[model samples]
Target: MTTLPQFALTVLGLLFCAGDVAALALLLTWQERAPSPDARRLRLLRGVLPASALLLALLLLAVVQLALL
Candidate 1:
């Protein structure tokens, strides 16, 4: 199979990085001070965010920047 063009790959990497940053921010700051009614949902998100960040990290790292030849 043909590889994606360099620009497409770079875009994918940026998206992954953005998602990871957003998740990291939510995990660190947004949930700390908010007093919401749905404690159960908040707990669920706490569990989910770390895993999502890890996945995004892996995806972002897998984008090899090999086009600078």
Candidate 2:
């Protein structure tokens, strides 16, 4: 029988990664005003990029554990 913690982890991991990916798509395709290279670099250095990277790292860790289990 599946336990609650496993089920919740699966749900939360997928949701977190999906949201992170969607945010990346939106940022990459933004049409309102194109961000300059410097602006993009600054944005990454400041917050969004690093945070997304962390999300990816966390997701990878979760998937690896899920697979081992």
Best by TM-score: 2
1-69: candidate 1 lDDT, tens digit per residue: 335575676677677767767766676565555576476468548765666668666755655442341
Report lDDT (CA) for all predictions. 0.62, 0.68
Q: Please give, for residues 1-69, the per-residue lDDT of candidate 2 as tens digits.
A: 667888887777777767767776665455223468776667656666666677678767767766665
Q: What is the lDDT of residue 54 in candidate 1?
A: 82
Model 1, runs deviating above 4 Å = 1-4, 34-69
Top of the candidates by lDDT: 2
Backbone clashes (count) for model 1: 0
Candidate 1 lDDT score relative to the true structure: 0.62
Off by over 4 Å in 2: 2-20, 23-34
